[model samples]
Target: MKRILLRLINFGKKLPLVIKSIKKIYRYGGYTAINIASINYGEILKEKKVLITGGSTGIGLSIAKKSLQVGATVVITGRNDDKLKKAADEIKNPRLKTLKWDISQINQIEEGIKNTKLLLEGDIDILINNAGIVNSITFPNVTEEIWDKIYSINSKGLFFLTQTLCDQWMKEDKVQLKKIINISSQGGFVGATYPYRMTKWDISGLTQGLGIKLAPHGIIVNGVAPGIIATKMQPNYHAQEDNVFCSLNPLKRIAMPTEIAELVVFLMSDAANFIVGQTILCDGGYSIK
Candidate 1:
């Protein structure tokens, strides 16, 4: 029966030719043939080596989990060792590695990347800079220290991380369609009542500029600007008797971390090769209103 099945499979190879001849007789030859050829060249999303910052919880954790589910090797970093250990155990994937590092410390980034690279066994194919901080104080109440912390983590850290990765990619001559997905905020695109918005705006600028600078080297830089995500960060605002932030969006609800994660995965995948220098708004249309 196995031999018979093999013979049948061999005969199936001629089926396309027969169909093409029939199409030719019907005066629609090339269309069907082109469609069949295109099918043969269909692309698949294979496993990648990915590094995500701030992956102990929230959107970062969500992205790490989804990357592992899609057969990628994931390396995650956070400032808290306990949270990193707990998250690693919870993820339960042998391909996932966790590191503890605070991105705000530029001096630590080199060591962080080296450690992450060792776990990945090479340069990362995708880098997701999801580490960020926020404060709820009004603009007038914002202090120099608050601005410095936010910018250091959200903008400066992300920029330097991408710089280090790109340098490594160039050194290794592995700059073919590499991706850098920066996690920004809806506040970057609209007015917000936090000093953190300034950092996110800088992220938007860096993403666009990096997209241009790296495009020649086959690297794509893009961002995901999420709005009102239902994460632990939301409680920092302290403005609501209830979850009033949920209703502030046009969607009338806050997004789950996984929703934003899916978008990050897509942007990092082959599906988004043509999508470069863009900040995808994954806020359930919240920015529109």
Candidate 2:
């Protein structure tokens, strides 16, 4: 009888914790249903034309695939012709085309756009500035070359490309509701610790500035800041079948490239026109911590 009473007391002590767990489950579980509703499987992006930078692999590749699936003609560009060919072959869709262009070469932006137009067969309706490089070197070890290398692609290249495209789109007056979706990093939102994070911060700030400046021009600009994702870039977690080992993340698992692609697709869709100048952080609640 004494043992039974002791057990009852222990259960009572844990009741509050149990209740909190249930509440957390209910909140996140409800988000799944809401997310399902947000996904418009009715071909919301049908007949649109999209251009994705660094589309040879990872998040860019996933976005290209998803855009194609939603009835959009897509042009994916990369610096490597071999990888571009491989990505094209992997997709095997007539509406999908590949271009070889190095975005870091700002001088060749026009030439690259010309070639991209040739493959796209017309001007692109949406531009995805997803091409970027990372330097994991920390502050003490960081060099000027490392900082410039990262910025040349992630910030400078993206800015110039958007400017080039916007110049053309603004003059056309025929195509309405153009969109630019920049792929930033969740690290951009927090204090920076490296060159990569600093570049991302620039991207996030540029996204907001462009959103305001370009709203009157009929172009909507937005961004997606992703946390640690399971990709080749994150070599440690890339090959794991179940990547739930992240201690800093609230969700306890890294996101897949496809997950980021889904959000990109949503941002590109007509349904998200009202959302501008905002970089949505899909970081599994990592920034909150």
Candidate 3:
């Protein structure tokens, strides 16, 4: 039977693939091992300096962990000092540095960047604009104050932060591979609400504009729009047993914080060099529905 199976598989002389039973005993040698999704990127980001905003919790903290796993030097910033200290202690990485930064305040932008650079001991090689705020109010309830608050942090602050980094990178004599990853939302793609949705749309546009302009300078700009992720930043509507949020999407479950982090790690990799200016949505299928 073994001989017959081998002969049948090899019968196709020019077939692209020919596989015989692997568990069967082999006189020649052991079966050729195949590994899928086993590529080790642990050292892909070695010696890379990364700055992440709102790294105290939720999606931002997750990205910081993934960056550290990939052997990158990371500087995380947030407004809350206690949360920052807690996060730093939990991670316990010598390569990790925490700073206090609030993206909404444009006046402090230079100081914040300088602080991160000092902690990193060099210019930032990567920037993850993951700090964002969203309100649950609907279109009718949307007010100027609410709109201003959301846009100030989510849209305006994000753009200016990227702009500052871009300006500095453009001044360099030899531009290297720099990354700017903006965290957008599914609301940007679909017609959901008013202010929060409007700000996200700006993020999507900003990603494209920057990607095109920075292509010549080796700065790859991209965005990620995630749907209902189970995180402190966003409210959880249903309990684990109910799984209402998950059912809304085709995947039958809301995304975990770590799941979204995986996508972020991919965007930061060298393999994603060509995926510029595009804001990829990580929403399980909520938008399509």
lDDT values for all models = 0.79, 0.86, 0.82
TM-score of each: 0.80, 0.85, 0.83
How many clashes in each structure? Answer: 0, 0, 2
- Against the true structure, whose TM-score is highest? 2
lDDT of 1 by residue, 1-289 (tens): 9999999998799889877666544542122111111111122335588899999988899888878777789899988899999998898888999988888888887898889989988767889989988877777798888878787888888888888778877777563678899999888888866778878888888899989888888889999999876577886322222232344666555666777887888888888898888899877577787
Displacement of residue 252 (Cα, Å) in model 2 is 1.0
Instruction: List the candidate 2 regions with Cα displacement exceeding 4 Å.
Output: 1-40
Supply candidate 1's per-residue lDDT for 275: 86
lDDT at residue 65 of model 2 (Cα atoms): 89
Predicted structure 2: lDDT? 0.86
Best by the lDDT measure: 2
Off-target runs (Cα >4 Å) in candidate 1 are 1-45, 236-245
Give the per-residue lDDT digits (tens) of candidate 2, residues 22-45. 665554342111121235457878
